[model samples]
Target: MGARHEERRRQIAEALLAIIDLHGLDAVSLRDVAARAEVSLGAVQHYFRSKDEMLLFALDYISERGTERVRRSLGQGEQPPRAVLRDILAELVPADDQRRAELRIATAFTARSLVSPKLADHLRAGYDSLYDVLVLLIRHAQEADEMPAGLDPERTAAALFALAEGLGMQVLIGHRNPRTALAILDEHLDRLSTTAS
Candidate 1:
């Protein structure tokens, strides 16, 4: 795609994400996205054949953005094991406006994914990618003797992934205070570092 076309699609996708963040997925329509994006309905339709297409594009866009941010924070093999885990888990929390906005879409899309297999696939892809990275990180920590001997990387990664997702939901719904959620995350990381050797 040309630069102009890519920019237009990104603009539309960002608008779609904003709408989902503000009014829930049910409020999403081509007109709403176009208005939010400050583009015309014809422009939205020009890029997305339908709402699902638009949503998938937005999910992919947000996932890439979220992944990039985490990678950047973790840096290139320099961060300590505990800090790496902390950064990954902390990124899942809605600590700031951008994370809160992204969490809104993630929460809404998770519900929609229950009945939409295509959406579920995209969601699963994002989660699985993160899980794989977490597994690798845990394994590295094991090789460095940070985690306990004989600890299972995949199992631990899965648990941490589940914990992060659950923490995000709890924080988003205000069921759990953000600080408390982060405290719980830190506690878990501390446990990881001090597990019986």
Candidate 2:
């Protein structure tokens, strides 16, 4: 019964995501979600007491999906620290249709967070996790001599994350292509490698 309940929640979240993707976040409502999911309004209400709850669930679901994809892409291997870090950073930028949709949803949630304390907290937590991981990876690279000796891991991690986020927005706005964005990231990584030597 627990599994079944969770599955139902997942379905509802997916429906909400699709709605956000197609109609924008402003179009989301309990009735629309129920129609999209082909479930009764009461069913959606059963899983989520309000629209904010539904959107929050969808945001978390999308974040987890992206994290899992990054983890799978960086599977266990004897890869160089720099190579692993490059893959991790690359995963954050939207390079395909699926990623574009995910980015759009994330951006929408970010805007919503400005007015929703609950969502702001959730977004803060998500970013904190990402920052922690990036800091760890940067520190690991420095220790392995893959990055410059004097570079601050925390600052570098924040800059890298900001760069990725800016590039992603540019890609979404058609100001830049994925390849160009990736090239810029590669150049930064190359500079780090050069500084290490």
- Most accurate candidate by lDDT: 2
lDDT of 1: 0.82
What clash count does candidate 1 reach? Answer: 0
Per-model TM-score on C-alpha atoms:
0.87, 0.89
- Report lDDT per candidate: 0.82, 0.84
Least lDDT summed over 10 consecutive residues: which range in candidate 1? 50-59
**Model 2 spans with C-alpha error above 4 angstroms:** 76-79
lDDT (tens digit, per residue) of candidate 2 on 117-190: 99999899989998898899888888888888788888888988989889989998889999999999999888
